[model samples]
Target: MQAVIIAALVIGIPLAIYCVCTVKREEIFEEGSGKNAEVLDDDGKITKETTMGRIIKMDKGMGEFLMANGLHCVTCTSSANESLADACIVHGLDADIMLSKIQKYLDENA
Candidate 1:
């Protein structure tokens, strides 16, 4: 019984530590390569289908607006996969209103 417990601890502790390290590494890579290096469409317009990461990549300043609107996951890995419409749905926000605001901001800034 003691041997089993020791073996379990030995295996489990290393496994847990490895998982944590792996996650941190992936986060670092995602932050550097995934978020900052993403390319925007040639038109550079914010549409419902535009991913949050692409929006931020197009204009980092947009992140502030998104956060203010309670869509603060702009920096998260999931943002790379999530579109404005999906994010708005998940956050209980009106997608049309958000898209309009985003386009207005882009127009003014451009």
Candidate 2:
């Protein structure tokens, strides 16, 4: 029936797109999977060089940490290119303290 066909398409198309995006994200971001991959190191902590967008995408806990630290710019346009240190500087936060907290959180959760 026409209704069945429409329902199938409505559900199927987005599901297909979601699958594709998920695969691509894994391929691109998985440790050493691609050039400039956003990977956790042997210590399982993000480096100061890690970008805010990568943190938001790869680790929700770190993203939450950023949010709690007053870097609400996590979702802002400039976040894509901003490192943790850069964000801390922009927000007038202590990068060393934030990094230590983040590292401790990752260690405990790991």
Candidate 3:
């Protein structure tokens, strides 16, 4: 009886974790679904991923893009709470231009 319990603990736990990790992890990173369209780049790459459904998944590429374009606020932790539109408004950055440039780069590379 004890041997069976030990075997079950080892095998069952691993199998359960594997199944949960594989199945649940994909759901966490599917995509955005709001009206904002997830702030895609010129080539349809996700710039500011707005899908805060399960966990935070900000588009790191967008942050790099903003920093490259002189928008330093992209690195701030506060950016996690703020939307792309609001950040542009506060930082006096042109959201359209930034987005356009990002998308263009994406299109070219893709």
Top candidate when judged by lDDT against the true structure: 1
The sequence of per-residue lDDT tens digits that candidate 2 reaches over residues 66-99 is 6787886654545667888898898999888887
List model 1 lDDT by residue over 14-62, tens digit each: 7886676546434534443222223445565556888775666555466
lDDT of 3 by residue, 3-101 (tens): 999999999997886676545434433442222334444654554433222112433243444557765554344444565556667778776676566
Which residue segments of model 3 deviate by more than 4 Å? Answer: 1-61
List the candidates ranked by TM-score, beginning with the highest.
1, 2, 3
Task: Kindly give the number of clashing pairs for every candidate.
Answer: 0, 0, 4
Worst 10 residues of 3 by lDDT: 51-60
TM-scores, each model vs. reference: 0.59, 0.56, 0.42
lDDT of each: 0.68, 0.65, 0.50
In the order shown, the candidates' Cα RMSDs to the true structure are 7.5, 9.2, 12.0
Which model scores highest in TM-score?
1
| Candidate 1 wrong stretches, greater than 4 Å | 1-44
